[model samples]
Target: MKILNFHIRGKMAHFRRYYSNSSALSYSVPPRTTLIGLIAGLLGFERDSYYGDFDPEGCRVAVGVCSPQKKLVQTLNLLMIKSSNDLNGSRQHHSQTPTELIIPANIRTGFLDYEVWICHQNNDLINTLHTRLEQKYGYLTQGVSAALGTAQHLGWAESARIVEGEEVAEAQADFFSILPVSNVISLHLSESRHRLRLQKEDMPIHFHPDRTIAGKGNFLINASAAPVNAKVKTAVRLSDERFITWMED
Candidate 1:
């Protein structure tokens, strides 16, 4: 049998290559961080679990991860018109990193018993996304095997939290700008809304979207169409498509 050699970062690099012309992402932690442990815990291997030791030396394996759909922008405390120049000044800005993941109420999960909130200041997308999957997607992924790069496929969500009043330095000058905008809808690994799974027999539970007042035509996003990176932008575009599909369904 042929063993598959999968590099977590390398796979993301492929995605980046494909979407580079649209949107690019900067990860706080590489996708490989949880892959090794996932393989060990899932295979029940006590020691080194090399591909050749179990499967084959050269096989084709697919890898994936649950990522956030947002971008980092410099914070400038200015009116919308005043901030127009801030957008133009981003030609030489550093890459933005993902800050957190957003999980909706248990309505997405069949149980509808508990409201789970997992916070991460670091690379928490993995954990948060995992929780959403287990609760909302009928636990499609399991054990340590369900990790970045080791899993059969990857997933993502678009809902996010906004960090306003954050300070970002530009040209050695301090400016307060809300770097990323959090979208109302998030992506989950389910074809149907998890809320629909609740049987009529189950106890009554009230689940609704968190209310927010915003002007029309305003959606959350991290980056714009100015830069040319398809991969980076694909995630957002995919999220939009998913939203449209969900609404239509």
Candidate 2:
């Protein structure tokens, strides 16, 4: 299988958790649905229209954090506009609400980076995306215009390369990537590891506005810690230093 690899970074990112209502909590990494949205956006697809084009069985994706993880909580004051007639005959009223926002910490360069891998059986879409990335056209035209999580937070692709990788045994390393929980055949602590900590997050894999659930799925990832020598049954070595476990539906 052929894979397209690229790097994306942003000044700030907030991948809001769907369940968080009062507070805007964020996922440490971009979820599968978010990656799909990004690809759709690059291809100039309409909102909520391209979900069916890329099925989980045919299109596979993986993401890895390329920067140190840091986050901060901020409160944003949003104006709530209501449309109604009051007893005094007022047509509308505006109220302010303070909402909590979790955002990535800004660095000296003011960017947070991530590595993305995409594999699919459809050659047309893959080739188009690869061409766009290589030519630096379409969605890759402007870095800031390509939004990652929210429309307000824009991200840019730093570089892209097509890679044909080989499968290898999983070894001890700091997993900066998000892996599907179902693909994990075995996991263990590292030889030099003292504490074993893993962050399990459930993110949407598929989405449809008409659907009731909006296609949700679960993923397990290590935010920053290095897991003990773990062995994955299906792992691919993208390069001399980069390795990722495939995500399964």
Candidate 3:
């Protein structure tokens, strides 16, 4: 199978947690569902129209942090407008909402990078996506802009290419990408000597055609984009000597 490989980076990102309440929280990395949504956007699929086309059973996704990241919370003044007459803030009731955002750990770099790997059962779809991505990450040909979580926080993809991978036996190699929690047998936290940054997140994996979330997953990821020594299942070894765990349903 051929996989589309690319890295997305932006100044800031806020992938709000699925169950966030008044305080808008964010996930450290984009979940599988978010990756699928980005792929759909690149393919120019209409809103809520490509769930079935990219089902978990057919399309596989993996993500890895390529740059260090950190999150900060800021209070945003949200205007509460009930009707059209209140559009100009004539009747003002501003709610200070604490919003969390993900950014690069260092300010000088100015980009938070996330590497994405994806493959689909549909050969034509894969080819189409590879072509679009080659066209400057699809912005020119598709006229679709890429963003990290929201439109206000714009992002872009670079180095689009098709690469081959071999399915490896369980624990064949150490994983560099995010791994589903269920597939992790052990983590080598001590061997890393405090250099590895780990995080656990409950992320959405799949959605029904009707737009309801269908599957959720718990995953372990290295936030610093470093290698993690761990025994994991469903491993895939890329041609470039990188390993990843699939986001299975």
Candidate 4:
């Protein structure tokens, strides 16, 4: 399978957890759904109209964090709307609610960079996306508008060259991408070497309402203080550095 590799970066990002209510929590990396939305935007697909175009059966996506990351929780005062019909009355009814927002610690100079791997059975779609990203013309003039969680936090991407990759037996490395817990052949944590930590999250992969389920699943993400030794099974190699597994059903 051929995979298109790309880089995404931003000063700050927040991938909100769906289950969080009052306090919005964020995922460490962009979920499969977020990736789909980004690609759809670049393709100029209407909102909620392109879910099937990038379904798991046809397209696979993987993401890896490329920078040191830290999480911080902050509160924002948000206005609550009670009635839209009564403008004068709505002001009296509206109240400022303090909402907790989970965001990346470095909101200014500290950039959140990620390596993305996208593999699709359709070669034309892949070529178009790559060409558009590289030229930065037509639909992808400013690059696709990407956000970690909310639309308020914006990011950009450029065309990343695709390269050949090889599979190795084992190596000590920090994982920057989300992987299926079942596909992980083996994992080793070293506090002195890698400072590795494990985080498990339930992420939504598909948004098509027609499906029996919305395509939600659990994913295991690796967080490392530094790179660690690991034995991984991956089908595609990215940038001669990272190995990525396909997002499967």
The reply for model 4, stretches above 4 Å from the true place, is 80-108, 136-144, 165-176, 191-193, 210-213, 224-228, 232-234, 239-241
After superposing candidate 3, which stretches have Cα over 4 Å from the reference? 80-91, 136-138, 141-143
Worst 10 residues of 3 by lDDT: 136-145
In order of lDDT, best first, we have 3, 2, 4, 1
Q: TM-scores of all models?
A: 0.20, 0.78, 0.92, 0.79
Error of 2 at 172 (Å): 7.5
lDDT of 3 at 34: 84
Of the candidates shown, which would achieve the greatest lDDT relative to the real structure? 3
lDDT of 1: 0.23
Q: How does candidate 4 score on lDDT?
A: 0.66
Ranking by TM-score: 3, 4, 2, 1
Q: Candidate 1: which stretches are off by over 4 Å?
A: 1-37, 54-56, 64-68, 71-249
Model 4, 2-83: lDDT tens digits are: 6778887777777877787767777877888888788777877877777778889888888776676767766664445556
Candidate 3 on 1-249: residue-level lDDT in tens? 688898888889999898999999999988888888888888888878999888888899988888888889999887788998877877767888999999898867668988889989998998888777777424443555668996778888887889898887667456778889998877777665436778899999988887688999898878877878777766888989888888882
Worst 10 residues of 2 by lDDT: 95-104
Best by TM-score: 3
- By summed lDDT, the worst window of 10 consecutive residues in model 1 runs over 240-249
